[model samples]
Target: MRAVPTLAGGFPDISEMTVARQVHWQRWLAAAAILVVLAAIGRAFVNGQIEWTYVSRFLTAKVILEGITNTMVMAVLAMALGIVLGVVVAIMRLSSNPVLTSVAAGYTWLFRGTPLILQLLLWFNLALVFPTIGIPGLWSVRAVDVMTPFLSALLGLGINQGAYTSEVMRAGMLSVDVGQYEAAQAIGMGRLRALRRIILPQAMRVVIPPLGNEFIGMVKATSLASVIQYPELLHNAENIYYANSRVIELLIVAGSWYLLVVSILTPLQMLLERRFARGALQITR
Candidate 1:
């Protein structure tokens, strides 16, 4: 390339000047080191005592499949329950009434303060405290029968999840501009109607990403229910390993399934975020 001489003492021929790119030798060395470490880990796993045959066999085993199905079922139901309670609690938390706010705060404190595994055990053993549970002068049933592993796990997980979810929902709601609330009030809309029509729809865009992450977390948290004898994927995997003594292999199978599920969920969550934030994207552009 030819450079034109400037009127002022000829400017360094700009077009002809070569721009040297900076070499990041340290980054290259770090990357190489990381790759070497990963390769060593992979080699160890491949040469480990674990039986890959058992992993492959049990990956699609009927019991494992059923366990995964149950896991998905419980995760969905529990998250749904949590979301419902979260919305209600968040509303109560933001209410004008002191009683409602205090109750909501207390609920959050009680659930969020306790360990989830302890909550699960408490629910499972509730029969010890309440031998019989039912409405007065109505149908009564033994607490032991009502508080099965499934129901106990559901209540424990869902209620605990609600406390966390309520915070997420409250943050989302608070993200909405005060002007938006004022505008809704300026219209003939009541508080509940305005919240349902104006506030919630706007809050959804801010909330979806966090809610997706929470749901994914809920999926993994279901594994904790295995302690209560809930037949989730990990529980069934444990049973298989217990019988066959292929602990690592069974664990690998369970881990692989969890990785696959989370991998799928990550992309879906991005799509959901895009869908909800479409208006904001358009406005920005």
Candidate 2:
């Protein structure tokens, strides 16, 4: 067979049309394959040969509301105490005194070194250290009564979170240019004022994103309080499941509430971060 060649003004001969068609078909086939796989997965979930009913039932109004309340309380309390402790530690770390610096370092080392679970357990059983804890001349409370699961969990989680947060804050403080400190001093700003007015404000930009992440983490970590019988989100869910023996359902309940809480918190954190970033970034058309 003679191969036909196109001349000027004549229809040009096209070669490899089959190759282009093959490429197009290959793309179509790939898309079809993906769609088929997706459809099968959706079918499996919808038919719930997977038992989604139990999960749905577990996400009742009462369960969800309670979980949210408990979770929020735990996260907020932990963050509140942690932040205050963190600031103090950051200050100590930045101080000129060697003893305070060593003390701050030791605190971070001890708490961050140990697992939080162990710390919680220790606090829960703290009465063993001293059956009574109070001032000798002042009013007192029994260690056994005062160190209830709730208090133990709070103290353990808050203190441990504080230790970790301290390091994060310290790093942020240190990251500020040393010249900022000198400039503040040159302006006759006292140490505390320089830190609060000048250095800390700048450090907040670096500190906040990680701090948000830490808050989110604390929400999950509150679940660990379950071991001590502290009635946080997961513990309450567990208690419900045990009573009703709807293990998977109650877990789904807990999971749903957690997802909702985190979802809300993430957007708020983003807003705060944007606010903090003001003047640090520029806008474009």
Candidate 3:
């Protein structure tokens, strides 16, 4: 019988690596021991130390679910705005006009310069600055009165998201080949038309994966909005915890909901990644 050759990094098609049966057994044993310890802890806390009566009756499922829903809504709205504004900023930065470039640069620099929490507070209190954000002799509305904590949080998160996403988009745009741009121009497309029709199509392939990461980051960032009285997940959890005084319970509920959301988004991100990477790996040779 011939001995199989082992390759480094990964198993080769023609060679079989030696399987560490002992190592596998040891790992299983270790995992079992950890599970046993966890089971022991669960058994100890099931009826003895954990004050089950208070947790069971006080931790209302409805409130926790509402918090989860609010969190998703905030994430969706903020990311939608962020992506739209980020695309505009990326385009502006790539534009021929100096004014557009400066405006886009200033926006990215200013927002990215400040902390997200500070930005949130700034939006929450924006009404204080202008009182009415409107053009003269045109439609006007009370800023503070109309922009509640919820709207403030949405705007803050979205705009801040735009500032960061703009850089990601700009980087992705730069990654595109100069040849593609030339080809678009050669096809009798105007600069704007070429950018919209050709550049953006290819740029998105690069932008999407990192953008998914930003979406995940935004999910966690929404928790900060609770400070401004936005009824997002953490705020909702706080309300429940404050009412029943079950701080840990409410926190666990909020964390679990966050885990669920991120878990769901994980698959979606992978799908998008696969879609974008489809033709990238194709080799003409």
- The backbone clash count of each candidate, in order, is 0, 0, 0
Against the true structure, what is each candidate's TM-score? 0.93, 0.82, 0.80
Error of 2 at 276 (Å): 0.7
Winner by TM-score: 1
**Candidate 3: global Cα-lDDT?**
0.85
* Model 1, runs deviating above 4 Å: 1-18, 282-285
Q: In candidate 3, what are the lDDT values of residues 1-285, reduced to their tens digit?
A: 775665687655463545655457888999999999999988875755445555555445776667667878899899999998998999899888999999999999999999999999988888789899788798898897878988998999999999989898888889889999889888899988887788887888888989999999999999999989988888888887788777776676677778878999999999998798777865564
Q: Per-residue lDDT tens digits of candidate 2, residues 1-285?
A: 666678589976766333433357888999999999999988875875446776776677576567667768878998899999999998998889999999999999999999999999999999999888998888787899999987888899999999989988999899899999999999899999998899999999889999999999999999998899887778878877788787766777788888888898999999998898887855663
C-alpha root-mean-square deviation, each candidate: 2.6, 5.8, 6.2
- List, residue by residue over 1-285, the lDDT tens digit for candidate 1: 565656467555566567899999999999999999999999999998878888889999999999899999999999999999999999999999999999999999999999999999999999999999998798799999999999999999999999999999999999999999999989889999999999999999988999999999999999999999999999999999899899999999999999999999999999999999976846554
lDDT accuracy of residue 15 in candidate 3: 34
Clashing pairs in 1: none
lDDT of 1: 0.94
TM-score, cand. 3 vs. native: 0.80
lDDT score of residue 83 within candidate 1: 97
